[model samples]
Target chain A: MTDKPRFKSARESGYLLCIDCEKLHPLSLEGELCDRCGARLHSRVPNSMNLSWASLIAAVILFLPANMLPIMTFKSFGQGEPSTILGGILHLLDQDMLLIGLVVLFASIVVPVLKIIAMTILLCTVQFRLQTNLRQKTLMFRIIEWIGRWSMLDIFVIGILVALVQLGNIAHIEGNDGATAFAVVVLLTMFSAIIFDTRLIWDNGVTDLPSDNSDEKDTP
Target chain B: MHGTPEQLIACHECDLLMTRVANKPNEDVICPRCHARIFYTSINSIERLLALSVAGLILFIPANIFPILSLQVFGQSQSEIILQSALSLFDGGLVLVALLILLFAIVVPLFQQVILFYISFTLHYRREGRLLRQAMHAYQHLRGWGMLEIFMLGVLISIIKLKDIADLHIGLGLYSLAALIVVTTLSSVFFNPHQIWHQIDLRRQKRATDDR
Candidate 1:
């Protein structure tokens, strides 16, 4: 019998202890390994980063059409109106919805492209182990991850328009080919941010987690 | 090192460092040595969102005031409403479009920015401090409402269709929107969630030591 470390041993019914660490919580967990760290208690998904990277690449390619093509179609009095990202903003200005126009232009156009570029840079640095501004690079990663979802604002609006403005022969709103690609761009970035770990930023060509005081050591 | 089919293995990251009696696949546990989270926890959430909120606030001014689009049809030209595009939709009897625009483009971003600023600064400056749980709850609620990109997509589609039927022209507002998007994206990417978590841990540790 092993005399494990003296942690509070639970004697409650239905409580099973982990033999290696000898800690107890609940039983019938999904895996054999600890879920937090890669201890061989159970098996789980591996190559998560690789899969995320592939998906991110696919999304990036699709981003071209998302930005370049017409996302929605307008039919009023039997005349067809098609607008790309730029045209929509201009149309808003023409209609005097100055603020809203600016918001759309910035959120949909500028943000997504910049995010792609930033992510590509971050991924490259991480993969190739480049000596660059680690702090600034990490900051850029955080920015991309947070704003990934809001880019779907246009898709959501289109969905609403298509759903709500179904007044046949008077006015109609329809989705276009670019919508699908746009959706992919949004979904990809969202997943890419979720899957990619920011901890890698602090890594200095080494696999282990950086020590907290390493920042002090790294500079001087 | 006794090997058994039911032998337990302990995880290094779990708070309750448990040993696995059975060799199960992908079964993660916490470590006894540290209160590190296990089983795929996001390193940072609030801090990342806060960065976006700040960017949104900064971009909000330009988004609201700039013109989104312009129209020239039949030698007579016009433009679309930005925030009030929804109002125009309503006037044109597209009530839902108007409401969606107002909610996502205007109201949501504004709410998220204000609340996020208050929470982060409060935590940062070491205020007498409201409950962390309460603050996190508000953040979660506010986070879901702001929908910037969706509104942008709508604007894009509108322009494309409008161009075919009418002569469309770009304006200063269009440029502003492009800038807003870039700022928001960068804000989200640059923020780190782990940093905030570290601050909280330091604070808690300090409290515990003071108690001792």
Candidate 2:
């Protein structure tokens, strides 16, 4: 690893790739629009960290009501019982639908909380420029981005149930306020992840550190 | 502009600039520093993309036209297609939520399929230039918005939730939706944007020489 030549980043080499057109342009055109497609050219996303932090904070605040309030209310013969996310999972478990229960548990509860935590860590690590575990951090960021969308599973379930189970006063299903909050939480976290630029994680890698003897010796 | 297309390959992840080396089909060119896949020579990619997109198009009709699932309680049954659900949500005063579902689950996926089909058709027929580039850009922009598979999983969970309260019956729409999800995913996997761009560049160069 020490003997290999260090790769120069586009930023270091004075070029920026247009995210829209994938065309490489000189860095002198940074604030100016892309000549090829007229899209804004930036070496990195502008205000990425600040925007990510704001969205993540909003998502964290919304997560409480999303899990606590009833997502769906079930009515049978004029008697109604509203089910929170945890209550719904426990109900499934009690009914011996272990597989479905676990799926809901993982998709609804575990995934969102884990996604929030992951985003917070990634944003903080990048903001503080912690050089340790940069590779692992990038991989974590990828995994979070990929799985963040799965949390929408619960919202979809609510939409379908609210539509299908409307039997008019006898055994009806109606979506409660929590469903909306849950949906917003999912969307906010996703936006936060997207707003974050994963390339920043590797900005302060070993190559950018103070010159060591190994690096000096490797340079011919 | 300064180098041949083969010499212009830059790793989007690590920004490592290197000349493109010849690789067999299905071989991936990975960035040495970041281990990100820079490009891959996908075998028979255009055909695979076209077939998958067509399959998704075929499945899209039944996925929307037929009832997704039917619920029966006390001998009274209610069924709805995906669109009706969104319409009902609109009626229920959840307009934003309704539109969100409609956009992500229905509209965006269909638009993505159409874009994929257009690009694959153009590529297979050896038509290149501005239209192909526009389609490629549209596909990239629309790629992140489609969530058909997530919607299907949500329907599955909904069915499970309804099982205890009523007689739940699966519909043709459900089956078509399952198939549609599979087809769309396969289409995205087989569609390589970099390869399509390379093809476009090659055609442009050829046309330039012919004109000269």
Candidate 3:
């Protein structure tokens, strides 16, 4: 409240104290907020880290089932039948799309699973109060979290096939239990990441510190 | 009526510093320096919002029931049921697509919508129930599973190619399924989860005071 600076709008009214000089500077209209003090006037989303982690966990869980279950049933000329996760990868191989097969295997199967495991470890470590490789874990988590949603390509393929391939009773497609489970797993992981509080990961270490006047004075 | 403190708030985009005050702006407030918007608690509604969400649940049944798509290749014609598609994919040895479709098209949507409705219903109508928070968390977890758009894309591609071969007929189920997608989207938009949580907190406080 001492030496409070005047501003145009309450929306714009906040103290922007520089970490280096410890002086208050008014926010600029050019960029986001004051660069020195990092005073933000507004926010984008709430608990983003929590949301990201929650989504990541849900994605990982879903990834497991997505690969384990049968995504779609293909009836071609009444001769085809349902395909499982590995079955589809093999089918791609059968279709001579080895590269696509591998890609699908890695993206839909490998990457997603790896991401889930990686995120789980990262989030769990932070959540459970065990922090060793915080930076590396966080970086890896970011990458996995970023690419997690794209793995839905396999699910998309199934949806496409189900929508198409309806040639009367001669050929048709259907979805099965496995597919539903897989989808749930994917969604669960996504939401897990979305709901998880990433900042909580950072908070476990500092929360136990003493809230004394000396500590408060040290910030200035 | 306690207000959130300044230190309690942070930038939504970058987690920078911000002062917390009661009744903050609802949307589109950016950080003056970083230009990052500082989003406080997201607008969330609880089981009460389920009243609005039931529409999505009702539409979901049709989304799954009717033929999502149909096609005719050459003189012969066929229809694809979601369940049958999974079976056929397994039979055809295209197991991956089969599994993928089941998960994205059927499982995820059903899970998300049902869970959401369940949570919202329990929270909104049944005031005395516990574990409402857990339900909200579960709903948030499952809501992303609905992969209607991705499924639609696959169907669209099939239609484009099938049209070259024979007459293509997309059924009422498919249209209803599409409408179901719209309904779910609208439900998410209209029902705010954070608001619901706030209401619950307020009620809890009021109840505690009354008990005291």
**TM per prediction:** 0.45, 0.90, 0.53
DockQ of 2: 0.42
Candidate 2 runs further than 4 Å off: A1-4, A32-38, A208-220, B1-8, B127-131, B206-212
Question: What TM-score does prediction 3 earn?
Answer: 0.53
Regions of model 3 farther than 4 Å from truth: A1-151, A159-220, B1-7, B11-17, B22-25, B29-48, B90-100, B122-126
What candidate 1 gets wrong by more than 4 Å, as runs, is A1-32, A35-45, A205-220, B1-212
Score chain B of each candidate by TM-score. Answer: 0.61, 0.92, 0.77
Return model 1's CA RMSD, one decimal.
14.0
Q: Distance from true position, residue A147, model 1, in Å? A: 1.1
Task: Find the 10 residues in a row with the least total lDDT in model 2 chain A.
Answer: A211-220
lDDT of 3 by residue, B70-163 (tens): 6656666566655665666666555665666677677877777776676566656655646655555565545555667655654654564345
What are the fnat scores of the candidates, in the order listed?
0.09, 0.37, 0.18
Q: What is the per-residue lDDT of model 3 for residues A106-208, given as tens digits with 9 covering 90 to 100?
A: 7567865786787668667866887564445655656765566656656566655654565556666676766666656665665566555444444444322
Query: lDDT for each of the candidates?
Result: 0.55, 0.78, 0.56
Ordered from best to worst lDDT, the candidate numbers read 2, 3, 1
Tens-place lDDT digits, model 1, residues A1-220: 2542332212112233332223332444424553222233311123545766887798888888886888777787788887776777787779777876777777777878787788778778768877566656765776677676677667656654554344456656666667667767776777676656544443333222224423211110
The DockQ of predicted model 1 stands at 0.07
